[model samples]
Target chain A: MSRSTPLREVHETLGATLTDFAGWLMPLRYGSESAEHNAVRTAAGLFDLSHMGEIFVTGPQAGEALDHALVGNLSELVPGRARYTMICATGGGVLDDLIVYRLGSEEFLVVANASNYERVAAELTARGEGFQAEVDDRSDQYALIAVQGPRSQEILSSLTDADLAGLKYYAGLPGTVAGVQALIARTGYTGEDGFELFVAAADAVSLWQELAKAGDGYGLRPAGLSARDTLRLEAGMPLYGNELNAGLTPFDAGLGRVVRFDKPGDFVGRAALAPLKDVPPRRRLTGLVARGRRVPRHGYPVVLLTDGTVVGEVTSGAPSQSLGKPIAMAYVDTNLSEGLAVDIRGSHEPVDVVDLPFYRRSK
Target chain B: MSSIPEELSYTKEHEWVAGLDDGLTVTVGITAYAADSLGDVVYVQLPEVGGTIEAGDAVGEVESTKSVSDIYAPVTGEVVEVNQTVVDDPSLVNSDPYGEGWLFRVRIEGTPEDLLTSEEYVTVTSSEA
Candidate 1:
């Protein structure tokens, strides 16, 4: 049986299409996914992210334990700040990408992908055995809601006096929202100005209702996983299974900047990843825009239009509402730039190599 | 529940067939339930107008935002016409699946394979739902 989040009833009430994703019955969309996508771009959209894993690490060696376990230097992260990092296997392949938030001097929250949270939590425990820190999986205790878009800050400001203006990107603080305690983080995946509120699971329903009531006049629609996927795709963000996998390192996925080798101690994949930092990868993650209407989807081959030689493969793709065309992220041969096409189904559809992000919100 | 027109026949694949009694050509399109399940239709590929197809043959495809499905032929016949409007603007499938979103018309050669009535199609969809 798929576990339902606290907002399942609310989603059902709103006539959402629910699907089993990562062992959780999550809302795929409330109505038209395109409308939901457009709402996030033009106004605001709410998201139920309770399926994400929240693993807490604390103690004197909390930061040190994370530094040795993951790629980034967590010990250097100041309190109330967050950093995107990755956990790699011993062979330097990406295990999972993560966000580490330093809540206090010793408390840190590690947010991980829903599908890999159990494995990630177990790995964090095993990796921190010799250290003085403790790992606790608190995923079931939290429900995360995100308000994203151009009008997100405006809508959220009406609910709480949490110093929304003072909050910087990648920073989080404990505060009260709608009479419930929440960790309001000025961060999101939609490539827009937004906030992600992490609250107790018990308070999820009330907080969602409060936010909905407060956002009624601002055009904040409840978005789902479908819009989230397309929004992140347009923002050039990588999905774990689609982009980063057990076989590809961060460098191969064009996210090597997250791997910090200058940290104090030796990390898990340091020895394997250090040698690969300077060496160029054979296939680099790139973006492709379809010249035709047919969408090039995941696992499709990126081939040369002239000779039909397979050079790379698509990881994630969608009909982008922002670009008004089909866009995809693929790992292409670093030596080749132009004259590319994706073998969509059986036909090779022409594509142009574009920059990573297909859409960027203007500040 | 998605509307199932009482006068139409449906295939187990979620396609609706109309004009079977007219004896010349029958219109085919996916049911509203199928279109709703597909979310937003982005692309529609229809078979050639002059092509011959057997019943149950996968003639073309309907690509949506999240996934794609094959459009199967419901009856053995020659493809007489295809919906150019649907091909141009696939969102019609979601907005009006039975009318403007009609996929194609086939000149029936013989009796179509056993298809469900509106009531029977409701049962099939309800069971799946």
Candidate 2:
């Protein structure tokens, strides 16, 4: 049986089309994907992210423990601050990418994806030999809801006393939302101004209801996993299963900044990541936009114009909600960058190699 | 799923066939119910005008964000004309599902049974719940 989130009933009640995803029943949509995508872009949107995992690390030297398990320097985090970090195996492959929340001097919360919950917990617990922190997987006890878009602050600020404005990006604060004590983090997967509210499992439904009601006038519609994927893809963010997996390192995913080699202590993947810094692999992921309306699908082969030789395949492709055209992200050989050819049907068309992040939010 | 206009015949593949005054040409399009269920039609790949298709064979493809569905031929026929409007403005299917959204007109050669009535379709989709 697939695991159900606390808001499962709420989604069905709203006529959501549900599908099984990564061992969990997730909502695919309530109506049209185009309308839902526009809602998040032009207005506000709500999402039930209760399927995400929340783990806690608490002890006398929790920072020391996190510094060892993560590739980033956790010692630099002050209380109430948070940072995006990745957990790696001993060989330097990624275990998961998560947010490290410094709740207190010796307390921290690591928010991970739902599918990676068990793996993240087991790896962290097993790697706790030299550290003084206790690793506890508290995923079941908590629920997450994200209010995203430009007007997210105006809607969320109505119920919270935490002074949401003072919270910078990647910062977490203790606050009360919908009459329940919760943790509000100024972070989200969507490339919009939003907050990820962590509350007790039982309080999730009421909080979502309140957020939806309060945000209704602002065009806040409940979004499903389908729109979430489009938003993240437009933001040029990586998905765990699609982009980052256990076998791929942070460097391979164009996230080299997360790897902190300056720190004196050795991380799990430090030795393997050392040589990659100077000379990375030849294959790189690049974004493409089709000049015509022909949108490419996933797993479509990219070919070289000179010899019709297949070089790479599309990892993710969709009709861009923001770009208003067919955009794609594909893994291409580094030697084939700048100007490459993508096989749409039987014909190969030229594609320009721009920088990473096909779309950027205007200031 | 409106009246199915007593003048028109229904196909099990969810298309409505209107026998035109020119006996050999039959106007064909998907029903409103089918279009509504498809949500917003983004892109469609249609067969050439002279392409021959067998009964139950997929003559084209209709794609939305959530799904990519095959447009199966209702009867053994040759595609004589296609709506180019869908290629430019695919939303025509959602706005005017039964009219401007007609996928194509076919010069059917043979007639098959199993086509449901309007009342029968109402019973079929209502129970599809």
Q: Where is the poorest 10-residue window by lDDT in model 1 chain A?
A: A259-268
TM per candidate, chain B:
0.98, 0.85
TM-score for predicted model 1 compared with the true structure: 0.99
Model 1, A32: alpha-carbon shift in Å?
0.5
Q: Could you tell me how far off, in angstroms, the CA of residue B80 lies in candidate 1 after the best superposition?
A: 1.8
lDDT of candidates 1 onward, in order: 0.95, 0.81
Predicted candidate 2 versus true structure: per-residue lDDT over A1-363, tens digit per residue: 989999999999998878788888988788777788788888888988888899998998788888888898887799999989999888778889999999999999998888898898887887777788999998999989998888899999888778898999889899998798899999988788889999999999999999998897899999888888888888888888777888888888878899999875777788888888877766787887766666666778887778889988777777777888777788888777754677876768666666758767664
TM-score of the A chain in candidate 2: the value is 0.96
Interface RMSD of 1: 0.4
- In order of listing, the candidates' clash counts read 0, 1
TM-score of each: 0.99, 0.91
TM accuracy, model 2: 0.91
Q: Model 1: per-residue lDDT, tens digit, B87-116?
A: 999999999999999999999897897789
TM-score of chain A of each: 0.99, 0.96
Identify the leading candidate in terms of TM-score.
1
- How large a fraction of the reference contact set does each model reproduce? 0.88, 0.31
What's the lDDT for candidate 1?
0.95
